[model samples]
Target: MLYRRFARPLLFRLDAERAHELAVSGLSRGWRALPGVPKEDPLLAQDLMGCHFPNPVGLAAGFDKYARAVAAWPRLGFGFAEIGTVTWRPQPGNPRPRVFRLPDDRALINRLGFNNHGAGRTAGRLARHRRRGHLGRVPLGINLGKSKRTPPEEAPSDYAESLKHLWPYADYVVVNVSSPNTPGLRDLQEESELAGILDALAAVNRARAEAAGSAPLPLLVKLAPDLEPAQLDAIVDLALARDLAGLIISNTTIAREDLASPASLAAEAGGLSGGPLRERSTQMLARARRRAGDGLVLIGVGGVFTADDAWAKIAAGASLVQVYTGFVYGGPGTARRIADGLAEYVHRAGLASISAAVGTAAEGGA
Candidate 1:
């Protein structure tokens, strides 16, 4: 009630990007003052990728392109939080007016181009948080993206560089090959293009873990929602072959089909995320699960806004689900709302654990 009636209208009044800046600032500076995030119901817990998620809902990457407010995430009720599509080099993202809201559709279209303070700078900040023992409550994932100016063939090293700087701080690291905003970024999703990137990351992952006398940090990939069937199959095959930790089922979609928003906002050139993307994203999650079988873990994203939406993703095969646009519209209480709702569903369905619910709605699922 507070967010919808009081915060949403005020946030909606500003330019979308400007409003995002304010929210980030507020969360970063005032986390300690915020009420403590309560423990999730036991049914919501899941252990995967060697980490225990207090709940299956995570704040998606791109929402916090920097670690500025990272400490606030678990406190705000997210089971985990991913920061950045941070690149090897810093670049001013596309132009202003790059982010727009579609209230009717409850979605966001962003062409922000992975703008961030760059890997080294962000690693430094996270290090400060680490030194203060503020880096953990829930898992932290660092999402790595290619430098916009880096050549396509060199994307492997480009992504690897960011990982090198940021890995120490990540509970897991995600290779972001999706995002419609960056020119040719999506192309990196191609098996040929992606194999090299994964290999580079794996090499660094092992070396770092060995140096630290710990297990290699889990590594996952984020993909775009617009991929064709064959493309998804080949990519899943490749991921299993390379032994990736998991996959973030999707990023955002370029297609604007079936939106309630006006054509002007719908036609904006970027990825469409939120209510409009739920169906396709869940469908893709099921497909990937089928291909990987028990060999891979999946994290579903795109258009999740409520317990029902998140549950659908899990039943479709996501071990966990993430929120980007949903958080934008659902506001601060989003995580708790979704977690509470999911617990109700778990009891209603008579499930032993939420993990057992994975892929239940799909053919040959759990």
Candidate 2:
């Protein structure tokens, strides 16, 4: 309520990218020193991918690309926080005015092009958090992307390099082959290409686990929202084949759909995220759940801005839920608000916990 009336109106006035920069700047500074919020509802807590998430809501990748605010996430009520879309080498991303706000539709279109400090710098920041004992308060996830200069064929090595550098700091890692802004980046989602990258990552993960005498670190794949049913199924197969931790069911969508924003802004060339994305992403999650069954964990993303939206994802089979564009519009209280609503849902449904509600509405699972 406060954020919408104050912070959001003020932010909407600033240039979109500038506002996001200011938000990250705010988080980076004052967070490390404060004690975070304690756990909320026990009903919302569940163990998945070897980590016990205090709740199912997580800050999605692309929000904290630099991993600068490691201590702030749990303090703000996120169950986990994913940083980066960081590459092996830093790049400026596509030129300015790359993010557009569609206030009418409550959506955003961004072609930020995976802009971030390279893995080396990100790892350094996470190391500082680790030294301060701020790490592992909530599970930390590092999302990897290819350097803009890397050819598609070399994507495997590219992702592996970033993962290798950031490995020590992350409880889990996401291989993001789904962003549409980077030329040919989505091509990496092809079965043959995806399989190679997953294979390479698994080999590296296994080696690290052996050295530490622990199980392999959980590794997940984030998908594009526009994929066909067959394509989504194929990726599920590859994830299982490679022994991945789970799948993040989706990145933003290229499809415009029936958006209420102006055609000029709606037609903007980038991935569309927020309200316009809810239905399609939920459908994809349900479909992927049917294909993977009990074998794979599915973390749902895309267009989730409220508890109703998050509940839809969980009912459709997401073991957990993540939000990106929604956070930009909804404010810092987003995760806590969503978790609070979810607790009501579990109680009303007579379920013991949120885990019991997972997949209760999927096509076949129900």
Candidate 3:
């Protein structure tokens, strides 16, 4: 309440990126001050893609671009933190005025262009974190994508290279074929192209699993929200056929029509995320559930600002849900509040388990 009434207004006055840095730095400092995060009920615990998570709520990728904030985030009640979309090589990304806030619509538009400190640097940082015992108990995933200079034909090798570097540290790996800010990145979602990319990654995963005497890594493909139903179906079929783990339903959208922001704001060139994206992401989750059948694990992310929003995603076919803009809009306690609220929602609805409610709202039952 204090944040909604005051802190946010103060943060909004500064340049968005500057404000973001300050907030992250402050959180890191505060985590050092506290003893540790408090324990919570097991109602929030879950298993997805063969790994167990203490809770279903997670901080989505892009929040901690290079794993700098991993230790502190677990204190904030995130069951997982996906750090990156890190490329094989680091680049400066887009110029300033790249991030914009649409307060009227409770949304954000960004053309950040996958800026990161490279996967190798990120892995080095994470390895150090492990040595320092900063990983906490929360699971971590790494999202990988193509560097700006990389061409389409070479994209698979680029992603594979990143995987080779990051796989040792990442509990899971996300193939980021989405993101509107990157030119031609979404084209990787094309059936033939996507298959080739996954095939290459799968081959590497098979070798790695054999070496470790374990099962293949949990590999997920993040999709763009703008895909048509047929495209979604094709991707779902591909996921199952290739034995990939799951899908992260809906990445930031290139669509501006659904946003309630002014025409001037909508004219901005970038992906729009947050409250405006809720329904569509949910709709996409339902679609993926239906097409992928009962087996695919869906991580729903888009406009989850409240517990109800999280419940809506759960009931529409998401096994787990993620947030970024919602956390920014709702303050530090946001993830805990959402997780608590979800458990309450489950009890009130008399569902035996959260899994029981998956896809209840939309008929696209998972």
Tens-place lDDT digits, model 1, residues 220-278: 98988899989999999898888888999889899989888999889999888898998
Tell me how far the alpha carbon of residue 267 in candidate 1 is from the true structure, in angstroms, after superposition: 1.2
Candidate 3 regions with alpha-carbon error over 4 angstroms: 364-366
TM-score of each: 0.98, 0.97, 0.96
Each prediction's number of clashing residue pairs: 0, 0, 1
Show the colliding residue pairs in model 3. 317-359
Pull out the clashing pairs in model 1.
Answer: none
Model 2 over residues 1-366: C-alpha lDDT tens digits?
A: 999999999998999999998988888788855456755678988888889899999999998998877778899889999999899998889999999998888889999999899999988988898998889788988999999999988999998898788888889999998999999988898999998998888888888888879888899999999998888988999888887889998899999888888788898899989988888888999998888886888999988999999999999999899998889989988988888999999999999999999988888531
Query: Which residue runs of candidate 2 sit more than 4 Å off their true CA positions?
Result: 32-35, 364-366
Error of 3 at 282 (Å): 0.7
The predicted structure with the larger TM-score, 1 or 3, is 1
Deviation (Å) of 117 in candidate 2: 0.8
Error of 3 at 196 (Å): 1.3
lDDT by residue (1-366, candidate 3, tens digit) is 888889988999998878888887777656786446648556667778878788788899888886787888878888788999899998888988888899888889989999898878888999998998887478888899999999999988888888888877878899999999889999999999999889888888888889889888899999999998899999999999988888997888988766567899888899899988888888989988877766788999999998899988887788889999999899888988998898898788887667788777767332
Q: Which ten residues in a row have the lowest lDDT in candidate 2?
A: 32-41
| CA-lDDT, candidates in order | 0.90, 0.89, 0.86
